[model samples]
Target: MIDDRILVKNVLAGDMQAFRLLIRQHEKLVAHMIGRLVKKDEEREELCQDVFLRVHEKLGEFSFQSKLSTWIATIAYRYAINHLRKQKIRFADLPDEESFTKHFIEETDPESIVEEGDTDAFVLKLVDELPPQYKTVLTLYHVEGMTYPEICEVTQMPEGTVKNYLFRARNLLKEKVKKYLGKEELL
Candidate 1:
C-alpha cells in the first residue's frame, strides 16, 4: 500500500494515475459516509462525484493533520448534510430507547421479517432507521473500522459525544435485535 503522504504528493505533482489511486483508496470511505446519510437512490452517485470533485479542488489545502480517509469522510459528510438541507430533510434525533425498541419490534410483520431474513441485512435495515448522527457514527466506527478520535474528526463531534453516540447506538440496536429475536422465536 502506498503511503498517504507520498500518494498525496504524487497527485499534487500532476500525476493522473495517482489521482485515480487516491480515489480508489478513499472512494469506499466516501461512499459509506454518503450512503448512510443520503437516502435518495438517484442522488447518491451524483453526490459521490461531487465529493470527489471537492476533494480534487481542495487537495492542496490538506495539511495532513488527519488521515486522508478521515478528511475525505469529513467532506463526504458535509456534502451529504448540505444535500439533506437542500432537500429540506429533517435530521431526526434518536427517540427514547425504550419507546424506539418497542415501536421497532412492533412495526415489523412476520412476513416482512421472513422475506428479509438475513440477520446482518436485517440489522443494517434497523441501523438505517436510526438518526443520521447515529448512523454516521456507527458506520464510521464499526463499518469503516475507524477509531473514536478518527470518527470525532470526521463528524466534528467531541470525543464524549462520539463515545456517547456509539454507546447509545449499540444499546439501541441490541435492544431491537433482542426483541426481534424474541418475536421470531414466538412465530
Candidate 2:
C-alpha cells in the first residue's frame, strides 16, 4: 500500500496516477459516508463522484494538519450538507435524542441480540435511516474512529458541539435499535 502522505504529495506535485491511487484507497469510505447521508441511489453516486472531484481540485490546499481521510471526510460532510440544504431539508427533522439513545443501547450491546449473524449490514441499515447530522457524527466517530477534535475539524463545529452530537447520535442509534428489536419480538 502506498503511504497516504506520499500519495498526497505526489498528487499535489501533479502526478495523475497518484491521485488515482489516493481515490482508490479512500473511495469506499467516501462512498459509505455519502450513502448514509443520501437516500437516493443516483444522487448518492453523483455526490460521491463530486466529493472526489472536489478533493482533486482542493488537493493543493491541504495543509496536512489532519489525516487525509479526515480531510476528505470534512469535504464529504460539507458537500452532503450543502446538497441537503439546497433541497431545503432541515437537520432538525433527522432524529430525536431519545430514539438515538434507544437504538445505540439495543444494537451496540451484543448481549441484547439473541441471534448473531452479520450485524454490520443491519447496523448500516439503521445508520442510513438516521438524519444527516446524526449519521455523519456516528460514521465519523464510531465507524472511522476519528477523534473528537478531528470530528470537530471535519464538521467545522466546536469541540463541545462535536462531543454533544456524538453523544446524541449514539443515543439515537440505541433508540432505533431497541424499537427495531422490539418489533421483531412481536412478529
Candidate 3:
C-alpha cells in the first residue's frame, strides 16, 4: 500500500496519475456517503465529480491530522449536505431517546423490500428510510469500516453524538430486521 503522505506529496506536485490514484483509493468512501444521502440517481454522479473536484482544489490545505480517507470523506459528507440544503431537503430532528425507542418497538413492519431471498436489499431499504444523519453515520461507520473517531472527523460530530447515532441507527435497523424476518433473537 502506498503511504498517504507520499501519495499526497506526489499529487500536490501535479502528478495526474497520483491524483487518479487518490481518487481510486477514496472513491468508494465518497460514493458510499453520497449514495446514502443523495437519492437522485442523476445527481449522484455529478455530486461525486464535484466532491473530487473540491478535493483536488483543496489538496494543498490538508493538514494530515487525520487519515487521507477520513479527510476525503469529510469533503464528501459536507458536499452532499450542502447539495441537499440547496435542494431544500429537510432533515428531521432526532427524537428523544425514550420516544425513539418506544416508536421503534411499536412500528409496523414495512412492505416486503424485495424477494424473500434478498436480505441485503431488505436491509438497505430499511436504511434508506432513516434520517440523513443516521444514514450517513451508519454508512460511514459500517459500510466503510471507519473507526468512531474517523467517523466523527468525517461528519464533524462529537464522539458522543457519533456513538449515539451509531447505536440508535443500529437499533433501528435491528428492530426493522426483526420485524421483517419475525426473528426474536437478532442482535
The candidate scoring highest on lDDT is 3
lDDT of 3 at 62: 96
Residue-wise C-alpha lDDT for candidate 2, range 2-117, written one tens digit per residue = 98878988998999999888988888778867777778989988999999999999988988888899899888878887888888887657445566555555545443343556
Instruction: For candidate 1, report its TM-score.
Output: 0.88
lDDT (0-100) at residue 48 of candidate 2? 91
Candidate 2 — which residues are off by over 4 angstroms?
93-118, 179-187
Which portions of model 3 show Cα errors greater than 4 Å?
Answer: 92-115
Sort by TM-score, best first: what order?
A: 1, 3, 2
The C-alpha stretches of model 1 lying farther than 4 A from their native spots are 92-99, 109-117, 183-187
Alpha carbon lDDT of each predicted model? 0.84, 0.77, 0.85
Superposition error at 169 for model 2 (Å): 2.6
Clashing pairs in 1: none
- lDDT tens readout by residue for model 1, 71-109: 999999999988988888866545676787677666754
> RMSD, each candidate, Å?
3.1, 5.2, 2.5
Tens digit per residue, CA lDDT, model 3, 1-187: 6899999999999999999999999989989989999999889999999999999999999988988899999999998988988988865555776776666656645555544667777678778877789999999887899999899888888999999988888988887777666776856
